[model samples]
Target: RRGDDGTALDRLAGAITYAARLIAGATRRTGLREVYSPSSSTRGLRKLDSWVERALLEKDESLSTATAVAAEAIRQDLPPLFAEVVGRVLLRIGRLPRDMPDAGDVAYVPRAGHHMPLPPWLPPSRILGGFYVLRPIGTGGGGSVFVARRAEERHEETAETFALKVPAYNGAAAHTLSEEEFLRLFREEAGALLTLPAHKNLAGFVTFDAGAKPKPILVMELVQGPTLERLLDKRAMSMPLALSILDGLAAGLEAMHAAGIGHLDVKPSNVILRYPDDVGAPARGSTPSPTPVLVDFGLAGRKVRPGCGSPYYGAPEVWDTAAFGDRTDPRATDVYAFSCLAYEMLTGKTLFSGDALPVLIAAHLTHQDGPESLQWLRRHRQAQGLAEILSLGLRRDPRKRLTLSEVRISLAELGRKRLASLSWPLRN
Candidate 1:
């Protein structure tokens, strides 16, 4: 609607009001929690976040002017969209004091300079019953992981730390799982980690509290290192380092299977390279790196659930019901998933790399042949042997897939040193 006085300040304010209503919705509520139901297909928070991003990036004169006016014109009762933008700005310019939800809660977001501010929705209280939450490390589908240490007044003793996993539904907008259901999963994860024996390769259990007031929490041994995903992004690995990482991960998976547990999810990101404290950096060199520890037991356990885990690395049996279904071998699935990671490690690209989840699922179910990366492996010495081993693991039939033990034996049999790039790899 063109106004009589298009450039006037009053016309601009009126236009902004009209736009906010039209965008957010005419009759819909603008406050948090009331805006969208948990099961609502179109989540309000995500919509608000998109608008915040749009406002920040918008270069159009009229749109930018409208955004600026909204930023300051909010006298009180800020809408979720405007609230998110203001919160982001406030977080950027520090001076956020810890707002204790309870007394004796000496809460503070440690290394505020190092970490991007924890969003307003997930503002964690430092004290979680008996554990001291240090800082947020990462978040996943049902919960968030934080670097935590045992509650102790003696600061020096607090050197020993743990990864405190707390069930968080505040930002579970993408998920359809109810808050109670998510928390139940978190509890099961804690149980699974607790059941497994203390192994160097796995993220060993520390403790957990299922009956905590607001929500439950799971504490695990904090693996101090970068994820394999981050490492892969930084540089291509040498043949030895790559093999070494594979060996470590295999051992962990083997151990899990032996104890009647299945690491249904096995990918680069799940593997953590735990380097010695003395080591200067993660870069490959003469210095020894320990067996890469595997973390994230969320999808882990002996139970057979169809169509689960990361789609990119899911095996044939994992994708199909008629082929294997609930009778699928957990060990074979892990081996196949590991093979996918191994393929990516040796070659610097994912096998079935794409965005379409459905197309990728179809590829896993039908396509068993080599991807485009095979040409890159051509003319190499150990490529043939490695390819053979990988073929056995990546077979469409779960029955034909290599067992973790079989994989380990085959890898040990290889004369990997012949692969010239077996010792020192480039960082780039």
Candidate 2:
């Protein structure tokens, strides 16, 4: 009875080892007579096989524990390095025993070259179908963005532009959100945008199409401007210009809020600056410029968009226990982000500086008033007389925050004051 059981274990280990080799795409010429067939030392072979099977079947998560015990038990009787090789082989097959650290054994290494299985649903395309690709622009976590021409249009003469976002092949799988769900959301975005009406200050969606293969491509008006993050990297903004940029952005937010839509992710990357004739102003443009527009609705949500600001710009309310879920006021969140941006614009530095550790330390300090933060506020006052406006605008408490309407009124006043500062030049 014991001999029969030993023979069965021998066959099982051989079969499992073969399967592991096949998965690793190793050639049949692994040069092991004992592995492919019975050997001269059948007694030794049977002994090693029995010990290896018992070790592998052990409940201990650490592969090294099993391998070490198996090696010691069968080393004298089995072939010189047979146990060592088989242990390495098993690890390559992803059966690494957990919880065994520093076991003084090399796990497993397989020869490279096996192509991983590709998902059946995702068909490869030389060029993405359904849209005429003009140029590839950038890529993000969800997909690649491209500048593409619209396939069909209402009027032949009306030149249209669209930013096409495509999901990338992560070399693992090809799957997508359901076509119906994507279309429904797409239509919802377009409908909401139409009610709000397209403007120079907002990056508007024209339409969305899910190509026959079920890949979604968003069509939006081409918005041009360096991201606010990029602008802040170069230098600080003058008080008058920062206010000008904020005014335009606030107006755009107001329109969005009135239409019952809240931009959840209102970071500097989503904010774009457009200047007349493609020539951005030297600083923030005290004079009339094109306008600043907001982009990226991928993270945009409806129903009082929650705290989605970047970690650095995120308000205190974002971490509050009472601020759970998406019910927090969008205006308040945007206002907080606006203050962070304004602070960066005037100081040429992030409100929280240095690496992630230092930044996180600044974020959690209860008594930290952020000295650099106060400098920008003071300079804005000196340059543009926005001292009073920013005083309450930058308040950490949401209850003390000003509404977008209040911000708009304050900005219009700032604009008038800036224009008044040049009262002599206008008179001449």
Best prediction by lDDT: 1
Candidate 2's C-alpha runs over 4 A off are 1-130, 141-144, 152-159, 166-191, 209-217, 236-239, 279-288, 304-307, 317-322, 357-372, 375-388, 394-400, 414-428
TM-score of 1: 0.63
For each of the candidates, the C-alpha root-mean-square deviation to the true structure, in angstroms, is 13.1, 21.5
Task: Please give, for residues 1-428, the per-residue lDDT of candidate 1 as tens digits.
Answer: 11111112223233334345454553364543433222111122223323333333343222333333334444232456855665454233123232325545645433321243343544255567577666666666536777767768425563887777775564322244576765665577557666788888999877778766555777777776656875565453667777788888888888898877788878888887777862423334445765699986656766544555577788876666555756777778898888888777766668677778888887787766444444445445544577777778887778888789998878766735353345433112
Whole-model lDDT per candidate: 0.61, 0.52
Taking all chains together, the TM-score of candidate 2 against the true structure is: 0.53
Candidate 1 contains a number of clashing pairs equal to 0
Least lDDT summed over 10 consecutive residues: which range in candidate 1? 1-10
In terms of lDDT, the poorest run of 10 residues in model 2 is: 110-119
lDDT of 2 by residue, 41-112 (tens): 233344444344444445424445444444453443234466466545534423644344564664543211
lDDT of 1 at 425: 35
